[model samples]
Target: MARAAKKDAGNDTISLIPDDPNVPRPRLHKLIIKNFRAIGAQPVVIELDEIVVLVGPNNSGKSSILRAYDLVMKQGSNEGKLETEDFPNGIVDNAALPEIELQTIVFDKAPGDRWIGATEDGEMLIREKWTWSSPNVQPKRQGFDVQKGDWDDQVPWGAPAVANSRRPLPHRIEAFASPEIQASEISNLLMGILKDRIKTHKTGGEGQEKSDYDQLMESISNLQKNVVESTKAEIDVVEGQVSALLEKVFPKYRIKLDAKPEVDPEKTYTPFKASADLLMGPQDGYFSKVSQQGSGARRTLLWTALKFVSETKTPNDGGTRPHVLLLDEPEICLHPSAIREARTVLYDLPKTKTWQVMITTHSPVFIDLSRDNTTIVRVERAQDNAIHGVTLYRPNRSKLDDDDKRNLKALNVCDPYVNEFFFGGRVVIVEGDTEYTAFSLVRDLFPEKYRDLHVIRARGKGIIATIAKILNQFSSSYAILHDSDQPETDKGDKNPAWGMNSGILSAVNSASDSSAIRLVACIENFEAAMFEKAATSDKPYNALVRIRDDEALQTKVCGLLDALLDSNLPVPDGCIRWNALEQLEAGVAK
Candidate 1:
């Protein structure tokens, strides 16, 4: 079994070398797209990270980046030829021919520079262009242009040898979309693995030991022959009936059925292929069709199967081609738990450096900020409105402190709700779990107003500033809520600015815009203030007891906040925090 490899220092490419110490994997370093759909005339250059993730809003060209890669690499056979609508704004008449250029670094053990003009960094450029004489043409003429050396001073478009060498790179591009895995796809994947294993077994050398292998192969051949024969016999019966019906109906014309075997028996007999169509349900029963299962189940099954096949080694003879896995929206139609499981698989997939995985997704469930090697590309419509521009966000050590880095790394892994901020329009950063709970209850009061606002726990007062700074980097508007911890002394009561000078509060205030980042400090702590306010009620003891009980806390908090908003009584001292919340909401509205 082939194990996943660790990243070599400074190397962004996967290790192409199998078990051999000398072989090097070909790595995709950069991609350049020009005049492609949703991409303008100015070339969009993207530097490939080890695990590249593209994320953005709808129609912002996130999928277009993946398609650009597919168009150039031809990952699958049915990528559909470049049509007129594929051009930007569906206008190809006045536009220049669309182009996709790829730069890769290949390390070959057997020496003779396979690259035309190899760069000092061992990078080579392969450019694919689509040209059509007229818009009416069904398929455009595709051309390959390869260049090596510096970006400037490159060769012309027709270099066959370099182009041929780069063809293997495309074979390495394997793209999988969500929930739509065809039967043929599963069959092909399984067949490829079985073929590689059989080849490996045969090359292990000769002896009586080979007899067992030969016998197994013979059994497989016999079974395949029987199946083919039975299939043909059935086809013959159907064809005969059709022909008889046609003769009776037309008298002059007869139907001829040419039912040749769709799959070659020699290539079709494999353990993997035999089990490709089989599906095990949640219970003991077997599902006849994968399509019958829920979308989440189907996606999980396909992803698991692909992961299994990817871990298998290629034939020693180098017959199997390497590929980069391109996945689009793996989180689609998945349950939360299933999405998390998918995230683990995706995160670990590219770690072995066996194959690179590039995914485009809108779901934050798929985003893991901890992994240093994962490259996040935010794609959005450019301000100029000509095309979409992509911004790369890689984990860097320079900008963040160790503690802040650890918090970010632990976010999705330990804190499941932090990712909600990514999907939200505004954020409310509260100091602890209690604050989070209270605010969440409060948010339910105005569902429409708070629909786009996400509440996140900062875990500690010290971390609130850090969380605010991090959110700022993503251009998020956030407000902070924390306990002032003010003492109940005469001097403290006299000073209205008691908690305003705290280090955490000062850090937050200085780091964020005064309007966008509002800070609310409870005079004595959230629970204390809530209790104080409930004390003013007619049944003070009962209200405090209701707030104390876990079951009643949520409802009581809602009732308390509602009462405060209605101005049914004098505002309680604890309810002063609501003013800060109002200001925050007003700023967010602006």
Candidate 2:
């Protein structure tokens, strides 16, 4: 067993031994929340991916999950004491207190370890409960006993003494959106870097700076002692008065005042106690505080500080605690160019081997579909009137080929609105720009009825299957509108359009049946069916002019839009559903 050793027999100070070399480090795997703010009594379990992205509407409980993790970890200072608002619906008389459970996994473990009821593959569960019944009782932390299938309160795994012994909790790093730059947030990041560097110097790090740093710390320590000695007379006078008052109650107790306040140099200073003010100036040399700058500059400063910490805190040989970053809407207050740059940095951060990232974003630029082991969770309030998080996209279910990945990356770069469907309720996937232009305009005609409708332009038929598969994974009720390029004669042939049609149907059928799917195809092409003409290169411009001037074409477009959005409406004429494709091919249905 590892033990701490005292320096002397009479000394009260003891030296701490390094963490156990044999025990495996724990990584946060999942979080289960119950009776917390915005979430009801039923537990909501969310699995943490290497790079998980949470995208949803406002006030949909996306931020609550991030706050819940910080509440349990207590790494960030933003979370204060729990109040009535912390409970579900702010009613706590007959309700259970809020509970947050952490599920962790440790790889390459030995036979038996300090984790009380860990599995053979090294899975462990720990929980924290808030106190609401009494004011004096603090929060409770416990572990699960797998053998008995119950929770055990005797376990002190996350307490201060046992946390850093053999089971070290991950260091939670957080950056949230604010109306303005918070000096304390930036100060904490900067001071953490400064302290880490000072620690490196004190511990036999290379260079003459180490000696200089030690000398500086010694001088400061001596100054702290001198100040206490000079105030000894004042302290004695106060102690005499305090002891006289105490003697009235005990009548036999004697009191002595010993004034000794010192600084350890490493343990004394922190960002919470002190602030680091950043000043910016132009070439003319008129410097001003960062707080006086614009919102853009302050946001940029926070981004830069976060990047600096991530760069400096590189992975060591299991000596440092693991880090999990919770970033809320990084694209806020950033210019378009800056948003792209921030997205690249955040997407690449998890590759550092010691960091895991989770972000809640409203911008599609922060989401990358090509990344591996990435999960996109869509948070929304369900019919049950409780918040729910559904996995909208994951790498395992996607099965994206190289070509599909290239197409997705190109779309992510070229089109800013390609991912808007992830935030919509009923989506319509169209093949070309003409359909997208016409359908979007028609949907706008009935703004209130089709307010939740999202029209996504695939730009090509090959990418339709990819979008369909993703929608299927989301379990969304959506429609796909495509062009039937050939007649029934070409169905048996090796036409690429036929192959693409089969692929789209196959993807849609994998997860949903006909009730949840709406497949519409325009015979020959969109222009041929709507205007009785051959396909033209300027179809998008023609669509605009025709929809604006021609009433007949506008009526036809509205019918198709209604068929796609409302399941009760039958498939409109000149448009073919999946089952009627054969009839249209034989010139019978149209």
Candidate number of the best lDDT: 2
Shift in Å, residue 372, candidate 2: 1.5
**Residue-wise C-alpha lDDT for candidate 2, range 1-590, written one tens digit per residue:** 22122232332222122244344345567788877778887777777777888888888888888777666555212343466777778777555777777765544321123333443343443333333342223456666654566676754333433342323233333444443335456655567657545544534445444444557666776777788889888888888888889899989676777655542443554324555666777988988877677777777877787777666754232344445677778877788878877877777666655457788888877888867868888887878878887778888778788888888887788776688877757889999898898887777766887788888899899889888877777755788888887634444656677557777777777765646788888877777767778555688888878887888888888888888877678766666777443554664334
What stretches of model 1 exceed 4 Å from their correct place?
Answer: 1-24, 41-46, 75-80, 108-181, 195-297, 309-321, 382-389, 397-410, 441-451, 461-473, 476-590
- Score residue 100 of candidate 2 by CA lDDT: 76
lDDT of 1 by residue, 357-436 (tens): 77877777777766666666677776776565454455552245677667776666767657555543567676766656
CA RMSD of all predictions: 14.1, 7.3
Q: Please report the candidate that would top TM-score against the real structure.
A: 2
Which residue pairs show collisions in model 2? none
